[model samples]
Target: MGNSEATLRVDNVTKRFGDFTAVEGLSFDVRAGRVFGFLGPNGAGKTTTIRMIVGITAPDEGKIELFGERMSPKMQDRIGYLPEERGLYKKMKIVDQLRYFAALKDVPQSVADKRIDKWLERMNLAEWKNKKTTDLSKGMQQKIQFISTVLHDPDLLILDEPFSGLDPVNVEFMIDVMSEFKSQDKTIIFSTHLMETAERLCNDILLINKSKKVISGSLREVKASYGKNLIALRAVGGEAMLGDRSLVAKATEHSDEIEIELAENADPQALLKKLIESGANISKFEKVEPSLNDIFIDQIGGVK
Candidate 1:
């Protein structure tokens, strides 16, 4: 919501198959050049929603707009989509697969070849370019799939669980690549169950549970709205302060320290004074704001 230029808009979209409702009254806007985070648990209609946006399936109600126009083939060509299910031909050569996808996206063969070569070298897949996808490791295949996704250099990219199967190192590499794409003014939307990735990668987020939006906004705004002001203290004598229920809501203990959530009306300065007076050695006394993971659990976990 920081910028108002809508690159993609879903207005009260609802989708159904027979008697089952996949997405009901879902609405949100993805601004241009921003990394939008889509969050939901398993079977929460995240994929279905992505499909609707990409024009794989039309909504039974409502509408979708892309670049100020209704969804169309023109808009489709400008989109890069990586579905949740990995779909590369295991027997196909990496270079051939990239060429095929690039063709499908309307890139000329000559242009596709140069782009493929450059991306393979940049992504460390140069040696594997001619190898069959089956012979490559899962991580290698993932890198190829990513190359295919961006081979056409689409304006809008929709990634479903883009980080599903990767180690910490590759995940960090993917994060870096995503930022690079954003720097080039591409609009990226990705769905993830990993809150830490979203925390570091996304500029804005939409948290949905059971096909309903529970939270949406910038990270700072969402954390501030949680209205939680907490502080952690480490001390040999602060056990007495923990006994005073008026200053703290809950105290969770560790081997050598404790984290306490403070009541809203309790003055932070007053609590620090009391801790000092109780002869407690303050090791850490920083505000404990709610993280995206905490908010995700509270909102999605609270669903009926």
Candidate 2:
């Protein structure tokens, strides 16, 4: 048997379309009871990889195992997948649509009914239960789709861009629900380009670029590997400091602060001294860790 603690494993997987390679020699393990982030920019093979994971498409090479077994049709009921595309029945009542989806997963009416009512109330959709899905706002529709995905109480939940249309409030709501799922030991794979959300929510992350794995590990480990050479500085009249190539390699100015990337072998103390000598009023200057967004830029050659 495969490692019992592993919820999902992708081993040397590769997928191609015609002459283009979508995912190349990818390998990773998602442990049980953790939120795993699958991160990449647009057209970075994120969706294609997700498709292979849920068995919507077969890998051109290598293997994928879920719950220590090869992915098969029988496992569908145990997996809740929220695709990037929205596919709710436009005319169906929200509650009825949820019931229909739960039934497809082999959940009996008695259980589905109870779960549907509970989830709708929990998601604040109880008041809109009888409304047609097409009549709900984008955020509301997204929540309904999310409810349909998890109402069956699946063991593994795969969410692709789950926060795509959500407002800040709904985004937090989704995060809270995912946390609840983790507390229940339900494994989740969250795929998105929003590094900020992934940075905050995921226990482990796999960052891909150009169809290849760029980094993979616990968020702490991955950030630590990048080293702390970045400095966040907030000061007045430091525009000239940005051009000092000896003290700074690259500087990106923000509305209220500047992100300074130190050149290799440059000393932070010397940079600070130079700023002081330049008569710049420094408010915030600290050796801070790089955010996932910064790491993504560095890894992918500054591609947005």
Candidate 3:
């Protein structure tokens, strides 16, 4: 049985393409009015799982439920999906394309026109309304695609790699738009390889690797599970001390500071004493909480 509050549920779902397993025993719930992130590295079954959730493809085993019921065509009117692959008609005008998609969702022509105009203006695409979609820049087209997804005002929105091909400014714009949707009590599920974005945007996340789940929980719980084993140091002359394996199991150097993974059972106090004795000028040295990126690298065996 699905949780009454869950907008979508995947129960031990698995998908196989010939002999290769695309997803394995995956189970998670997207609760209503929450921003849920589906995170994974490339080929980590993110897209495959998304396809199954939207009913574009069926899972070989297990069950999927939307709105406390088995997934079916009736749910199509309630879902707005933006695939990773861009699919706008190149030659079609932006307004017409959006209108066509809205109509497909059973929105009336009059209503679609009003919503299209409002969305176009909000997305800063008002001037390009009559222009061919192919003529817009990639970022502009991305905004148009996003507008199309929400034009029908569906209860749930599933976006795959929505930030791809967008500049930083446009990415922020999309983030703001998502925040607005959440404030309006809409449910959202988005898949991304960008851990930073996911960390900032999602209320809950499921991190997968090589077709299997590595972690799934609220962001705070997942990060807290790793404990404070990471040390962030910003120093003028103590970077060389990071090479001492007695203190650090692994060290990653940045332009301004270095992050070190402490050796097992190594006391942080003792490590700080050693760095001081090494004639280093340390500006910042503290046991900092691990970031989602750090946790991901640790769990996945490396950075994506």
Q: Write the per-residue lDDT of candidate 1 for residues 176-207, one digit (tens) a residue.
A: 88998888878899888889888888888998
lDDT of 3 by residue, 123-218 (tens): 888999999987999889889989889888988899999999999988998999899888877889988878889889999889999988889988
Ordered list by TM-score, greatest first: 1, 2, 3
- The residue pairs in collision within model 1 are none
The lowest-lDDT stretch of 10 consecutive residues in candidate 1 is 227-236
* Cα-based lDDT for every prediction: 0.86, 0.89, 0.87
Off by over 4 Å in 2: 1-4, 230-285, 302-304
Give each prediction's root-mean-square deviation over alpha carbons. Answer: 2.7, 4.7, 4.8
TM-score of each: 0.89, 0.81, 0.81
lDDT of 2 by residue, 1-304 (tens): 2323889899999999999999999999998889999998888899888888888899999999989899787788899999999688999998789889999999999999999889889988789999997789988889889989998898899999999988998899899999999988889999988889999999999999889998999999999888758899999875787788887999988888888999888999999998888899999998888899999889888544
| Two-way lDDT contest, 1 vs 3, winner | 3
Candidate 2 all-Cα RMSD: 4.7
User: Weakest 10 consecutive residues, lDDT, candidate 3?
Assistant: 1-10
- Residue pairs clashing in model 2 are none
**Model 1 C-alpha RMSD to native:** 2.7
